[model samples]
Target chain A: MTEEARRSPERAKRLPRAVREKQILDAAVQVFSRHGYHSASMDEVSEVAGVSKPMIYSYLGAKEDLFIHCIRREANRLLAAVEAGIKPDLAPDMQLWHGLRSFYAFVAEYRESWTVLHRQAMSVGGPFADEVNAMRERAIELVAALVVSAGARRGLAEQAESSGEGMAAALVGAAESLADWWLDHSDVPDGVLASWLMNLVWLGFNDLVEGAVWKPAE
Target chain B: MTEEARRSPERAKRLPRAVREKQILDAAVQVFSRHGYHSASMDEVSEVAGVSKPMIYSYLGAKEDLFIHCIRREANRLLAAVEAGIKPDLAPDMQLWHGLRSFYAFVAEYRESWTVLHRQAMSVGGPFADEVNAMRERAIELVAALVVSAGARRGLAEQAESSGEGMAAALVGAAESLADWWLDHSDVPDGVLASWLMNLVWLGFNDLVEGAVWKPAE
Candidate 1:
């Protein structure tokens, strides 16, 4: 063995807790996204990370712990991206547009993270499902707040027929499904995709806040 | 074993091929929904269905084939439900509302089927993903056609800026997500849940066709 290897054989050089944790989490995300929660193994995560299994355990606790960490990190990164994209000073519609655009862009850039959070983590269906569901609720609430507050500013919040919670749930669902569709149709610009949703949802939402209803013309 | 059990050694009677296949698919859906696609096993499916593994194989092919079959059956059932709900003679808005009600009712009745088709199948992410995605595309097309033809009846089809495909993707996503939310909030009636989506999407959609653009108030 080389002198340095002989001196310290565990790692090239021991990384700080934060850097090592990041590397392990990054590798964990890749492995989890590919193999899914139950199918994924700690050995695979370690091999992918180029770190040893014991180190992974010491650093991330266990398989479940590592998976949860990946979910929380990616979820926050996503929420943070949308939050950063929204400028409170901008008009509400503009703010919503920016949030949507930021959402699409984030999914594009972090496809693995998005897949892990949106697809794999939720698939396991246990405590992890609840964890991811909480994240989902937060996301829905953020968008719903945007929709309702925009209406509230116009003094039309109480007059609306639909509840903000339900509308926000639909809006988040639309954006999410569109994002998944965007994975295939990557040629479409994020702005256009976001605008399509804006027209499909916000226009109807604005009218509803103004108390307009579409009925069958008998 | 009782005399009847000793005589047959398994199963109560020699059911026909079609009846046997239905039994297998029903069991497969239950097992897949409870344990998810990857964790679910042929043995468990056999136990659940009261059929031998060979019978499952002969009847359904393999695990993947079984999953595809379950997804296909459920997707067709859902699409059929919506189709049955729509009457061509009805006004566009009413037809859409009927379709929405049908969707919610289907989910409420066959939630396990919906869980397998909507959540578990897509989560598996392989040939099954393609199969489910094609089903999703068909669903989106169905809804988009409804929205566009309604606009056509109003002579506002050509004037609209958004394509039916994009808008439909948003609408289907909203429904799928809202349905997921509905699973937790079962106290809400199917009609209310369906109406929430109708208002969230159709109302805005109606305004869009009428050339109402929601722009930031400058």
Candidate 2:
């Protein structure tokens, strides 16, 4: 073996367990995002991580366990990114706008992470799907809090209390659906995507809080 | 055995294939909705439909095939219901309002079918998920046409043409997410649910057509 190649394994062996685990996870996410769960291989993950397969197994169990870890890690990262993007001091609309911008930015920067957490984990179904769903619920709850607070600000606490969670659910779904659409239509910038949603949802919500409602003429 | 008990199989035999198929699908949807695809049993479906297991197998192939059939039937029924609800003579807002009402109505009337087509089918993943996704795409396209036409009415055809599909995807996602939320919070009637969405989306869409937009303050 070449000197560097021979020493690379030795160098990997000296890394701390947590650092090695991160390396494995980073590689696993990449592999899973590319091949999906069913089609992804441990060998490729091993080769990509520059860590031995046995080391990966010891660190993260088997393929299924490894895939789940990738999902949970990526999901946490996404939620944290969005949460961090929201400046609590801002108006609710600005808070939501910043949140959406952070979300799309994350999706844009870590395309593979988004793919693994969203498309791959979901298609694999079972526990993997449950993980994604749980993350989605958290996101909805986060937005619901914002919606309720905004309504309370407008002296419509009762109305917002009743519908805030539901509206948040719809908004979260729209964001997710739009993100999926963006995967195919990547020509659209992330800022533009966030703006489109803001135009669609924030203005609509602004009207609701202002007591302007749409009624059928008939 | 009683005469009716003894002759039931022969009576089932005498029924037309289409009628029998409907019976099986109805029962399958009910069972699948309750137990989901994997946990659902052919025995339960046969018992519910009053058809023998052998007949179910012969008609629908197997559990996988049966689930696909259920998804297809329910999807078609849902799309037809929404399309039929829309009157081309009405304005775009009215048309969308009618469409959402019809969709929620269908969910209310055929809760089992919707449960199977959306929750059960999606969680099953693989080919079942594909069927549900195909239905969603068709639904998006249907809404996109309406959005584009609405923009045309406002003389903003170019902007509408550019963003119509993405907006439609978001709208469909919102409708679906709200429907899921409604499944848990059903005290709100379907009409109210439709109106909630109308307030959330239509008003915002109206603002877009009117050239009013939300901008972030630096």
For model 2, residues A1-218, the per-residue Cα lDDT tens digits are: 66775877556357788999999999999999999899999999999998889889988999999998999999999999999999999999999999999999999999999998878877778899999999999999999999999999999999999999999999999999999888999999999999989988889999999999989879
By DockQ, the best candidate is 2
Candidate 1: where are CA atoms >4 Å away? A1-15, A24-57, A61-67, A87-94, A119-131, A147-162, B1-15, B23-68, B88-95, B119-131, B147-162
lDDT by residue for model 1 (B66-100), tens? 99999999989999999999888887778888888
TM-score for each of the candidates: 0.77, 0.96
DockQ of each: 0.44, 0.82
The docking category that best describes candidate 2 is high
Q: Per-residue lDDT of B122-151 in model 2, one digit per residue for the tens?
A: 777888888889999999999999999999
Find the candidate with the highest TM-score and give its number: 2
